[model samples]
Target: MTRRCGFAAVIGAPNAGKSTLTNRLVGAKVSIVTQKVQTTRFPVRGVALADEAQIVLVDTPGIFQPRRRLDRAMVRSAWGGAEDADAVVHLVDAPAQLGDSPADRRAQADVETIIAGLKASGKAAILALNKVDAVKREALLGVSAALYETGAYDEAFMISASTGSGVDDLKAKLAERMPEGEWLYPEDQTADLPARLLAAEITREKLYLRVHEELPYSAAVETTAFQERKDGGVRIEQTIYVERESQRPIILGKGGQTLKWIGQKSREDLSVILDRPVHLFLHVTVDERWADKRAFYGDLGLDYDA
Candidate 1:
């Protein structure tokens, strides 16, 4: 039998459900997801099989206006993921793109930025208007027409990544684009991320979900150690780094309840993902320059100087 395998880069603005769609396409939780925007900081490769085709999906970071080094790096990575891919899917939050609220306007602006970038690169992408369940069909059609007129997208699809609606069609479309080759990964493999990195990301997602507004963006998680026990479990140690000393208490909370909750929730997820008993230890540290550190960016597959 002939085999096919290729990369498909999923690019979009923050909170456009790129991670959600990627997880759905891969039939596994390869990338972390939360309510926060720009939660994804790097490209995560999730392997999916559609018929005889193996589609390697690159879940890239949200493309947005870059003000900081980290933001620039993330935007660069998003585009870089598309550069070498066999197919590109530009996901957009439909309701937000068609709304008038200030936050919605900002989301639309990010989409516009991506569209312009696509035009400048002279690349065509499959536009996926996400969150169709939350928007009216008439309004979605209008938005789709306007974006399609930009001539940056080869086709458009309306989907609700949260509900798995229209996702299989998109997966099939991506599968059809795969080049003829040997499968890049084993049939059972779902993600390409290292165990240590995946553990850190899980802890980071928990931290982001627990913290109040804006605090999550200022926090970062690093897996300091991942050790396999003799019996058959794993012990993971991670450090949660915040920008200022004042932020430490915010994460720790009164009586360390907040940190405790974060650890417990993260451990639960790690256990399920690793399919083994996971002992997770978390520590909070104040590092004002954590975002500027080259080592931190390198660990997460980001360009520090971008």
Candidate 2:
């Protein structure tokens, strides 16, 4: 049998489970997953090797209304992922589309934005109605209808990214769609993200999970130091930058409690992922304009100004 390989850019709105789907298809976490909106700030490519097929999944940032330089850049990167891919999977959160809440309506609007982009580019996508585990069958049918009516998708799949339901079928379909060619990446390589970026993302995940409102959005973490211990363990040092001194105390908590919690959670995740004990050091600092500067975004392989 000939080898099959190509890129499949998984694009969608925030909280759409695109990251979760990518992680599942790749069998490991590459892009960070969070409850907060706009969690993914750039594209993270995760490679999914299935039998003779190698699907290089470009997990792009959630597309949303761009209110700042960072947002514009992120949104640009998201569409860029789709424009350059051999296949595109627009993963929609089906539950959100079914619910009668303002958040749900917002999710619908984002999906429409993607459909519009596909139409403008004359691109046909593989629509994946994700999070079906949380939604009723009838609701999923509604989502499927809306997407199908748009005529923006060539195929569709209903999947539960977190539960692995219908995922194997989706993977088979995605693999079948690959064009015959040599693999773009080694079969053993799971993700294209650098360790530093992944480390920073893990911390950011904890931040979004534990913090609230403006703090998580106003802050970013970068790995400043990574060293190997003689005992075959790893030590990581990261600096968390916030936009204000007042927010620093919020992140640090009354007795430096919040920071410690963040450190513990991040270290736990690192240990599990690396399959070795990890020592994580986290320090909080205020860098009010980190989000507005080009150099900072460049470090994460993102242009600050779109």
Candidate 3:
């Protein structure tokens, strides 16, 4: 049997279930999912095996109006992912686009920006309407029709990423588009992220889950060290950076309970994912300019100058 492999970039507005869809297609949690928007900061490559085809899923950051350097870099990274991929999947939050709330309006506006970007690039994408279960079929059809009329999409699919509805069909379509080639990774490898980066990402996910409202996007997690011990266990040390000294209390909590909970939850998940006992250590620091640092962008594969 001939093997096929290609990159598929998944682009969308914040909270459009791109991460969830990537995880579902890859059959594992390679990207972090959270209720907060912009939880994904970089492109996470997840490998999905569809028979003889290897679908390299590039889960890019959500495209939004840029207000800061970090936001600009994130948006640039998102478009860069789409520009380099063999296929592109533009995922849209159906219910949000059909709603009238401020957030919903912003989401809809972001979707329009994405469509315009695609048009400017002269690239046609496969539109995937996410969270279809949350909206009526009539509304979905209307939304689908309006987007399809934009001429930026070649195909449309209504899918509920959370419930695994219509996901297999989308995956198969992506697989069929892959060009014939040797697989880029081992059959068992699901992601290409370094262990240190993956560890930091996991800790960052837990941090966001704990203090999404209190902490802004200024907080970052970095794995300082990962060591294998004699007992077949790993010791990982990470530092969580906050932009302001006042924000420290929110992460540390009263009696350091919040940070403790984040560390415990992260360690539990890391142990299960790594299939080894993990001793996770977390520390909090106030770095007002971490986002502006060049090293930070280099670590995340983002264009700092963007």
Candidate 4:
């Protein structure tokens, strides 16, 4: 039997359900999902097996207009993911694109940016109009047709990534498009992220979930150590860096209750994902320039000069 294996880069605006779709495609929680924009800061590769095809799904960061160095790096990384892929998927939040709210307008603009970028690259992407369950049939069809008319997309799919609606068809399309080649990862492997990095991402997800509104984007989590214990358990140490001293209390909360809760949740998730007893230790520190540091970018697999 012939085997197929290649990368499929998923690119879209912030909060367009790209991560959710990637997780759905991979049939596992390889990428983290939250009700927040710009949560993903880098490209995360998740392995998906569709029949004889091994689809290496590259869940790139959401692309949008950049105003900061980190934002530029993320945008560059997102496009770079598309540059080396056998397939490219442009996921859009259908409701957001058709709505008239200010946030929706912003989302629409970001989609426009993606379409313009695709046109410049001269690469046609498989358009996946996500969140179709949240919009009306007529409006969804109108928006889908308009987007397809732009010629940036070669094919279209209407899917709700969260509900798994119409996702199987999208998966089948991706599988058939994969190039005939050897598998890049073991069939049992679900993701290509380092364990330590994934642990840090889990912690960060917890942090954002707990205090996302209270805290800004100036906070990050990094795993300092990971040790295999003699008792067949794993011990992990991590630090949460903040840009301001005043912001530290927001994450720590009154009498450290917030930080404690974050740690407990992170440990619970890490234990389940790793299938081992996990001892997670968390620390909060004020690192005024964590975002500007080269080491921080390096750890997240981002370019400091981009």
Off by over 4 Å in 4: none
lDDT of 3 at 290: 91
Residue-level lDDT of model 4, residues 53-88, one tens digit each, is 999999999998898989999999999999899899
Give lDDT tens digits, candidate 2, residues 5-83.
Answer: 9999999989899888999999987878887887888889999988999999999999987888888889999999899
For the record, the alpha-carbon RMSD of candidate 4 to the native fold, in angstroms, is 0.9
Candidates' C-alpha lDDT: 0.92, 0.87, 0.95, 0.93
TM-scores for every candidate against the unseen true structure: 0.98, 0.94, 0.98, 0.98
Looking at model 4, which ten-residue stretch has the lowest summed lDDT?
28-37
Tell me the TM-score of model 4.
Answer: 0.98
What RMSD, rounded to one decimal, does every model reach?
Answer: 1.0, 1.7, 0.9, 0.9
Order of the predicted models by lDDT, top scorer first: 3, 4, 1, 2
TM accuracy, model 1: 0.98
- Which residue pairs does candidate 2 place in steric collision? none
Error of 4 at 272 (Å): 1.5
**Model 1 C-alpha lDDT per residue in residues 178-239, reported as the tens digit of each score:** 99999989999999999999999999888888885748578889999999999799999999
User: Global lDDT for candidate 4?
Assistant: 0.93
> Any residue pairs clashing in model 4, and if so which?
none
| Steric clashes per prediction | 0, 0, 0, 0
